[model samples]
Target: MEWKLLATVFASVFIAEMADKTQLVTMLFAADRDVSRWTVFLGAAAALVLTSAIGVAAGAVLSEVINPRIMSLLAGSGFIVIGAWVLWQAIHGGA
Candidate 1:
């Protein structure tokens, strides 16, 4: 277990999830449902974990086919595009 890799995963996931829709949906679901909060929380967390695992596995396979540097560049550019879109929406008040 590389601590650095683990730390990177933790930090990236935390930052990505902080403003994610899944988190918001989870909060809304928990608020609206009559179910136990702990159950909802666990369910949401498990779903997120499974989704992340899928993403990681896909990335790993992609890395084997593509240059890692190229992958990093593409991923970074994608994040930039997403951030810009969010900023645009915030400024324009979603049209």
Candidate 2:
């Protein structure tokens, strides 16, 4: 196993997830008096693992069809476009 790759992915995902909707939803579940924190943790972990598996599978397929450089460019541009759209919406009061 590549420890460096593992740490990089872990840190990137951990930092991104810190303030994401998943964390918020998990927090809400944990706050509910009747809900079991262990159950919430298990459910959240399972969901994340499943989603990650899908991403890995998709990437595996995509890599066979597309060059990595082009993929990176597309991914970066997609993020930029998304960010611009969000900013526009914010400026326009989401109208």
* Candidate topping TM-score: 2
Point to the candidate with the largest lDDT: 2
Clashing pairs in 2: none
Q: Give the TM-score of candidate 2.
A: 0.91
Task: Write one digit per residue (lDDT tens) for candidate 2, span 1-95.
Answer: 99999999999899989989999999999999998899999999999999999999999999999998999999999999999999999999994
lDDT for residue 46 in candidate 2, whole number 0-100: 99
Q: Candidate 1 lDDT, tens digit per residue, 19-41?
A: 68988988888897677899889
In order of appearance, the predictions have TM-scores of: 0.80, 0.91
lDDT of 1: 0.91
> Local distance difference test, per candidate?
0.91, 0.95
State the weakest 10-residue window (summed lDDT) of model 2: 12-21
